[model samples]
Target: MPEVVFPLDSTRSFTDQSLVGHNRWHPDIPAQVHVRPGDSFRVHAREWFDGAIRNDDSADDIRDAPLNSVHVLSGPIAVEGARPGDLLIVDILDVGPIPQEDSGPLAGQGWGYTGIFATQNGGGFLTEQFPDAYKVVWDFSGQVATSRHVPHVSFPGLVHPGLMGTAPSADLLSRWNAREGALIATDPDRVPPLALPPQPDSAILGTLSGSEFDRVAAEAARTAPPRENGGNQDIKNLSKGTRVFYPVFVDGANLSLGDLHFSQGDGEITFCGAIEMGGFIDLHVDLIRGGMDTYGVAENAIFMPGTTDPRFEQWLAFSGTSVTLDGEQRYLDSHLSYQRACLHAIDYLTTFGWTPEQAYMILGAAPIEGRLSGVVDIPNSCATVYLPTSIFDVDIRPSAAGPVRIDPGQGVPRSSF
Candidate 1:
């Protein structure tokens, strides 16, 4: 039986016995599945709930939580004979949805990312009051689709084991043992269970951006504005057709993916429940050199069109907010807030003499659409910075106009034009 290496992460608490890196031989093994350049394969991933509950169908189920709620991704089928330099080519073939044939308790069959059934202020910014936190429930006897205000924005959870490396550097923080139900199957043999160590925190990451974006996220987290326009979901549009690229790391990327989403609102405010189940995924990996080529660097960066990027962004934006509430939201006017943010970001790079295409092309590759650090957290409606770490390869700085160090301590962040 040709095997796949489960992408192993060691950051938080994942358990070995948990379905972390195990693979279920679809219909056949690696050899039987013929892969061509354009050929696609539809792999039906198990739901995050793994079909544990019996006919559960209410948001309360998600709120109440189930036994295996921690999240466990499946896979690690070693390609028939994929090698180190070779890339994994995938195309999001199509979604083979698990119809309401056996509906989930918390997630309704008609549950889309937005609309009456959408998750509320999740981890996103909201002008709504905590006491008045609200979510409009939808009534659909079947599928989670709708023709309402939302565009047909579909995408894959495209999750991976997260830790696919050999300690790139000795000093690097090890994320192999992240506390969850996962195990690094070194030889296809069952690994022993291990206990978690005390004291910690965790999440996904991005390429090094010299901390500009990182600081921006931090500053936003610390700041808070009294009221804001809306709670933008800031979700990555992973509809049917989109190929995500990741620079090759460990052997075959030691990939693992869970947190699959049916639909996720932007800013991920409500979080990744729709993202909880697996999606039929297709991928094509390529080895691109010089990580980020032209996108300039900012401490905290986001590309134009907020809440949209391949790499996930996080922020302290949702403090004291009822992030725990589902279906809470409201939209507003100020369309330019997003436009201004994008324009400001592009202009920041253009100041370095790079054309918009240069900026766009470079940014298109390694963009790390960062989390929205809430200016609402602190005192100002401080705009969130769109920092893509890939900017480091471009060699520009916020203080490039002069040698200045910017941060929350620096009062306010200004573009050094």
Candidate 2:
């Protein structure tokens, strides 16, 4: 076992930890721990919601989930000698659920959840169809996940951290706030507002107090969107053995991460999607001085994905165009096309007795593939979603026999505002 630099107690709240972490992104959030560039260490991360979300069969928690306090990252662990204009190399050595404990109220104790957020809370990619909140709890056995709510399916989890990033420089953080705040000002009262602005209501900056805490909280950027600093990118391929290069904007390169997922499909389509869990991540850090400018990687993270991602020889695929369900056409909108593809998959799954929510959960939590298959084809961008055929208990491939129906047990739990 590596040296556990930041340890977390499964039964305690994130704020009660020995070395507290922040929920928002701010360079001023002092580094609670320090590691040398060549150090190999362990970090215990709380699930995004801390332990507020439960492992039971209800979507009430999802509906009322605290949006303000999220992503609950584990560090601003400064790397010694890491400086501006450099690139920090992060190697994910290992990651998994809580060590040694299998059963507990906390997530990642052999179980985790996938949730579709309510439109009023945080609308998902398919929120137009799934307006209400829905929840599915999946049990982990070795590397696979099986759900009672979404039955007749089991698949290997592609466990990885859903959020990880280096701290933003003051100028970069100002730019983030300016752009995101401008977007929010357009629809300040919009339900599930355009973009989350910095709010001091639930800000958690490490070890800061007095007016400094309030000032920093008001100026910090929310961890909901991925920015130049790499917050909440949600890339599922960043699993074990992946090497990532992040541009450093501040001295010491304060890096933080959390929101581990047992598995997630491409895009994490559902808003609160992925099999969200609390876990430990083993990391090894190094530096590439001046590599940011040396490689023209000035913003965002670039990575060589791990070779150990789950493999499936055959897949059932569905594709969709940029045309809306109501027949409105949009030009070159890959995001809209992907949403339509996922909706098409949900509709097809309903033919086999799985509820739409169950199908959406599968797409969010399984190792499914999503691709932009036709972006250059004129007005209509085309996106395709591929599901591993083996994950389903019944034959899902198109055949002369048509689709085979399987019993969907108990269905996903639901709650609405």
The best candidate in terms of TM-score: 2
Q: Identify the runs in model 2 with alpha carbons over 4 angstroms from their true place.
A: none
As a TM-score, model 2 comes out at 0.99
Q: Residue 317 of candidate 2: its Cα lDDT?
A: 94
RMSD of each: 19.2, 0.8
Which prediction has the highest lDDT against the true structure? Answer: 2
User: In candidate 2, where is summed lDDT lowest over 10 consecutive residues?
Assistant: 396-405
- The residue-level lDDT of candidate 2 at 103 comes to 85
* TM-score: model 1 vs. ground truth: 0.38
For residue 417, model 1's alpha carbon misses the true position, in angstroms, by 52
lDDT of each: 0.28, 0.92
lDDT of candidate 1? 0.28
| Candidate 1 segments exceeding 4 Å error | 1-39, 52-60, 66-69, 77-90, 99-234, 272-279, 282-417
